[model samples]
Target: MLRFLNCRCLLLAGLLLLAPTVQAARTILIFGDSLSAGYGIRQDAAWPALLAKRLHEKSLDYNVVNASISGETTSGGRARIDAALSRYSPQVVVLALGANDGLRGLPLAQLRDNLTAIVASAQSRKARVLLVGQRVPPNYGAYAIGFHDVFGAVARARKAALVDFLLDGVATQPKLFQADNLHPTAEAQPLLLDNVWRGLAPLLE
Candidate 1:
């Protein structure tokens, strides 16, 4: 009986010692703008939230941190990147900005510079990156084309993952958007998750 009790105590101690390792899941930071921040939709209905559920369903050990802010531009993201990096220390960073920059018709060079800086910062920390792309209306003509290409240019130069456009399918459909015609409705969140997953999945391993 004494021997059995000692064995049981040792087993319990072993589990206690291993508990933190089992729970210390790596972090995935969704660093983006209004789209990722769930603008005009319930926080739970956002794609980032769905990502957490999907990770759990797949039994992937990762904790997600949605550190996005609505109206975030590449410049704004650059300003905050260091603080965010120091705070989360994420293993993966879903870098989604420049939409607001495109919308505002900011200089394409400005967009490219800020994006390069943001990706470089994350890479410096050894964090994998999924750089989400954005585009302005065709009415902007050459400027819009330049804006769209900047995301890819930065991604290639930095060797980060790229999602060509976050709202690729949803953007074409009027019904998928909110009243403001900028944000996607709650129903479109899953589709957004699907698009992001393509780029994100590759970096998970």
Candidate 2:
């Protein structure tokens, strides 16, 4: 009886050990820019880091990879996407680029094309994409409007989920913005995570 009971306990332990491995966790990749990179903040204080914490709180099994680089443009994102995709093999990719392109006055057409290619590449790898939009400073004039439209257009064309503006809540709010008035303050990280979670939670389900 003792031997039989020991065997049963071992079997239960084996099952327990296999449970988490049997179900692979989903991975979400944030392919973005300075805003997403936590520019002046500690790495753990970034929105992506907060997002991972949020996921944990909700008991979701996911790996959030922040591949954001400060000053990265749509073209830069497109160039490095293949490597990111290969390394992360994410189930979802948050495409949040193009702001730098607009800042530099790069042709909107080129920006559009770069984003389109990035989306297509992710899709080809069977990854669902969430396009995160941005608004250029008003000084860019009509170009700012055009820049803002690019994300929606691409999302519509590709049938991807669109987060109209990644900085929706903090953009105009002085307290939420950092000294440079570009990136959000660390205190606003949760709200930023909330914005992303609203669009991302459904995809996980």
Query: What is the C-alpha lDDT profile of model 1 across 107-166, one tens digit per residue?
Result: 999999999999999999999999998777778789978988999999999999999998
Pairs of residues at least 3 apart in sequence or in different chains that clash in candidate 1: none
RMSD of each: 15.4, 15.1
Model 2 misplaced stretches (Cα beyond 4 Å): 1-24
TM-score of candidate 2 against the unseen true structure: 0.86
Pairs that collide, model 2: none
Where model 1 places Cα greater than 4 Å from the true spot, the runs are 1-24
lDDT (C-alpha) at residue 158 in model 1: 95
